[model samples]
Structures are given as C-alpha cells and as structure tokens.
Target: MPAITHQQALDRLAAHQLVQVIEDDVASLTSTAMSYAKHDQHLTVAGYVLPRLLARWNCVLNASNDEATPLYRDKTVLALALLLHKHGMTETAITKRALQAIDNLNAAVALSDAFFRNTDAIKALLNTPALALKKRPSTRDSLTFLRAQDVVAIQLEQYYYAAYVHEISGFNEYPIIEFYRARFEHRPDMAALQGCAAQGETYNDGKTRISLHAVCGMRHVPDPANQFHLIATGITDQPDQSQLGASVGLHTISNLFQLQGVMRKTGV
Candidate 1:
C-alpha cells in the first residue's frame, strides 16, 4: 500500500496514510493507552507508555537495536513527563482519561524542521510553540553564567567547561581561537573571567560594542561535597590578554544528563 505522510496521519487520522510503520505503532500504542486510561487502568497505561518510551530512548542514544525510533526524544519524553506531571498535579478527570493526547506543541518543532529544513515554515514553527515557552530551555536552567562581580575569593574551587570555535556572524564567517567560557551561573565575579568579547553583533549600546577583552569561561560544581567554595583562580581570565591559558577541561558524562523539559514538578 502507498504510504501516507506524518502530516496526513495527523490531519486525517487515517491509519492507511501512515508513511512509516513506526508512526503506525506509535498511533496504535497511543490508542491502546487511551483505552486503558478510559477504563481507569492507570498502571497499565504507564505499562504501555514507559516501555515504549524507554525503547525509544534506547534507540535515540543507539543503546538498543530497535527498528522503530522517535527522533525528538525530548518531545516524546517531555510529553510523557508532562503527562505524569499533570496526573500528579491536577485533579481534572479529563487528563486522567486522555493521558495519551499530549499537549506539548514543541514536540512538532524538530519534526517539521527536519522535514522542511531551510523553509521559512521551520523558523515560524520553532517560534510558535503551542505552549509558547522557551525553545530548549535546558541549558539555561541547568547551567548558570557568572559575571565578574559575583566572584567569591576562596580556595577549593574546581572548573568544568566546554569550548567551541564558531564562525563569526559578520566578521570572518570562521575564526580560530582556543578559548573557553565559564557558563556556570552560581557565581559570576569569582569566575576569574576578564572582559569577554561580544561574539554576536547583539550589542545594542555603542559602549558594549566597543569594549574589548570580554570575560569568557565555564564553571561547574557537580558534587558540592568537593565544593570549591571560594574562587581558586581560573587560568585564562587573568589581567593581561597574554595568557596561553589552561587546557579545556572535559568530563566523561553519561547520556543521563537531565533534559530541561517543560514538565513542571509539584508547586514548580
């Protein structure tokens, strides 16, 4: 049979239009979850969603040899997370019944973007979330950026950061620099960072544009037990811009890093 597009599947709800067999499976599982939810089989509903979710998660990270996959694990997981959140947060009966009908529209962002690519439609869709929240608020929430003022003068400080060299927006389109920024926001001034360059042409004011030597660095305190309470001094952000600086530090992290999803916890 001729396959149908994902759009057709959503627009028509005609199972025959499903292009990929995976889409069909998602739909079928959704239907089954709803049926179970309708009959107040909440635990069974979890049984249906969680396993499929994990299977998708495994495939997302290529942890398993699953044939079917969900590209936007953020969305699928966020939806499930949100559903579970709502189930616990609200007393409404409808959600408890329609647990399968996820409300996050952000999930569509990645899908449509992949499908349309450079189209203006992709841009528009990204800015237009059905929930209308920050697009990819994970880093913003998880990590903090520090300024020069908040620097704490103490010992035992440790450093964790990531480095990247990007092509300038209007300048060289490409530039070579082996520098890093301390993004952790817990304490800014203590980051030992000096004046950092405004990478983007986003300086609305003339002074911001003219300023040189922007403080760029990264700070991470994963386990506070080994806490670096005071600023132990960073390598690169010294007084003069003549420092070769320290080598970029990296930790072998797992895929288990928390996804800053929209699912709010209780009283959150």
Candidate 2:
C-alpha cells in the first residue's frame, strides 16, 4: 500500500475519509492515527478520536504483557510526554510566548498525575538504581549579576516545562532546576516551597514569562534530614521544573546521570 502524506492524512480526516483495513491490522491503523494525531490541531478530533482508536489496538494486544521493546519504550515515552504537554499549541514559541501556553497553575498538578499514571516506564526509571558523577566547579562568572530571590520560573518550550532557581543548597546552586511536562502543576506555597520563596508577580508576567510565577529561588534552610530537602524548591513560574525534577530525581535514584536532552528555551 502507498504511504499517506501528513497533509493527505489530515485532509482525509477532515473530510472523514477513512480507509478500510482488516481487524488484525487495527494496531497499524492505531499507530497511523497516532502519527497523524501528533500534528493534528483539533483536540476534539485528536484527543477524543485518536485515543479511542488507539484503544482499539490496546484491546487487541494485551498491554499487561511485557512486550515492551526499546522502540516501544522510547516511542511511548515521547508520545505520552507530547500528549501530556499539548495545550492547544500547534507551533513552537520563545520562552516568553511559551509561558502563556502552560502557565495555568492547575495544569502542573494535573500533568504531574497524568505523567506518572500514563507511563510505567517513567515510574520504573524513577525507581531504578543508577550512578551519579561528582560535582564540578561552577562555570558561571559574572557573580555580581546573580541576584537572590525566591520564585519558581517555569520555562515552557516546545513540549516540556523547566524550572530554575537562584541557588540550591548542597549542590552549590541556589535555584533548584527541574523539568516537567507543561500539563502538571507545582505549588510554591506547598511544602515544596518551604525552603524557597516566590518572587515577582503571582502569575507569569510577560517579562519573566514564567508559567506559575515570574521567578522562584531556593531558600536556605538549616539542617538536612532529607538530602532531597536541599534539592527542594518551590514550583514557581517554571514550566519544566517537574520534568527536570523527575529526570534528575530518576537519575539520582537510577544512577543514570549521563542522560541528556535539548534545552529548547530558558526563563533565565
């Protein structure tokens, strides 16, 4: 069979022109739908329709079975991350513009739950054992430019959210850095912010262009019961804080410190 172009698939879907295929081929169809869904803008069409179609594949295949291969793992993670990150955006934006896309405080909370719930691989990675590298000297020079402030600045890039802090405790940095899907929400007032303080406006102003707030910085807390405590920072106006947090937390837990990803945007 001839492969369909993205525009062709979209046009077909728009015109409700679906092709007939065998029941056994439902998985392939679902995968095709997913491919199209990736670029589709109409959530009513993509979210509602694609999920049900994907479910047809699930019904045929036993999801409980450990048939997960490397391709499966990578694809699912990326897909879930993308879906979880989606928020009616069809194009990429600068750090400022991206903030408006995912700054809804509640989104962070919702996505946090969805992210962990949707992907077992992420959970496994979080719980797995991994190694870490020794700390290196800071490369930052212009020390005078560094300001002390408590605020969570979430950077919403393409599909991910990232949080930055002025300084974190033990790690020789103040701002606790974390990345998460744009769908989730983190609270600066929660225990997560006990060691940190919020700075700038309550909501993301256009200047800082953070989702939750303008900026969030780590508060210096005395005593250290939880090593993670030092790492604790409020979920300020950052979009990717949770992803970064999960990524680093999983790395710290799984000994997988060598992982890397592209930094598409920044709140700093």
Candidate 3:
C-alpha cells in the first residue's frame, strides 16, 4: 500500500475524532489525581504526550490484533510514565508502577527489535525521500518548502517519543537524517549557526558538527533512563537558530536516539 501523506494522516485523525478521544482519555485518567499547583503544568505535559499517543493508538487500532498487542503494550508503558510524571510521581515510584504492570521491563524491551516498527508514519518516512529545494525561490516559496518538511518531522517526533519511553531493537534512521541533511546542505548559513554541517563540509574548519554527533551517539547508550535524559537535554540545548532548524534538530535527535535504543537492544 502507498504511504499516507501528512495531510491524509491529519484527515484521518479528524475523521475519527482521535484527538478528542485521546484528550478525554488523558483527562479521565488525571481527574482523580490532585490538580497541579498550576493547571498549565498538566496542560504542558499533556500537550507533549497526547499527540504522540494519539498517533500510536490510531496506528494500533488499524493494525491486526496480534500486531497491535505488543505495540499497545510498549505505548502503554510510555503513556503511564509520562502521565504519572505529570502527577509528580518520582522516577523510582514511576519505575515501580511500570514494573508492577510489566512482568519484566527488560523482557518487554526484548519483544521488539526496532523502534517505530508499528507506526505508519515510520513506513511513510522510509518510503519518502528528502525534500528537493529549488534554487533562488521567493520568500513565500521557501516558507512553503520548509513547512512541507516540518510536517514529516512532526510525525517522526511521535515515534521518536515512543522509542524513548521503551527501548526498541532498531531504528530506521537514513530517511530522517537525510531529510535534515538536505535542509542543512541547502542553507549553509543555517547549518553553520545550528552547528549541523553536512558530511564532509569544511565550513566548520574541521570541528565536528556537535548536533550531528549527538544523533550518532544515541546508538551507543544502553540505559533507557540515561538515553531519555540525553534526548531531553538535546532538545533543551538546541541553538536558537531558525525555528524550522530547531524543530528539525528536535526530531532528528529523537530519531537517532530511538535508533540507538534499537541498536542497543538488538546488539546491532
């Protein structure tokens, strides 16, 4: 089957009222917990967590029962951890809760051999090539081009978040890294400012691109907890360059780390 476009995925969500259902699910789950000192605290985390969960649930629901079970289980661990953390649960407590629900986290980790194996977006991304840029385009044209790429990055971030929560076997990284690399290569100024030179670029005077290295390093981290911290830190420490660059960096790092988790689990 042909992969769905970003617009088609959005349409699917709207058609099924998927956002509302997931939002309601989060609300219902949090309703009994004490309200945050400030409501936005909960809103902030929900904003971060829901869209990804919705994407996963949408894919899982459409998949076969056998395929959905393990996907659902993996997502469940992530969802519970984020939700509990929003309610101010400590890491130790959160680990305990996840452990109690899961027979063995390591065994569950071993069930899958790849990050985002069950997500439709990953399939779509794998099939799609990096965006091709036109030379000397107008400001409007450039904006349109960047926006198109951003949509794919948005979809990738969902799966990246899922992989971060529970370790996976392998992460398919080529398409995603290529997507960002195309953008950087096309705009060396942005690339230099973001410290993400394309392969073999001498613009940085032989200093390795820190952002690029960060993504590659994720494949080596064995502990999910440490890996999670690394990813969060990367997002927070992103250079304040173009907003699009920041967004691309965020998703790119996520893809790399998830790929890393997959590598660690599968010994790749």
Give the per-residue lDDT digits (tens) of candidate 3, residues 169-249.
Answer: 233222222222222111122223244322211223444231322132222221111112122211322332242222223
lDDT, candidate 1, 101-137, per-residue tens = 2222333454343333323332232223223122211
From the highest TM-score down, the ranking of the candidates is: 1, 3, 2
* Deviating ranges (above 4 Å) for candidate 1: 1-19, 41-47, 63-120, 123-268
How accurate locally is residue 99 in candidate 3, as Cα lDDT from 0 to 100?
41
- In order, candidate lDDTs are 0.28, 0.26, 0.30
Which regions in candidate 3 have their CA more than 4 angstroms from the true location? 1-43, 70-176, 179-268
Range of the 10 consecutive residues with the lowest summed lDDT in candidate 2: 251-260
lDDT of 2 by residue, 87-199 (tens): 11121222122222223322434234433342333323222332221221122211111222333222121222233433433444333333332221322233343333212
* Candidates 1 and 3 compared by lDDT, better number: 3
lDDT of prediction 1: 0.28
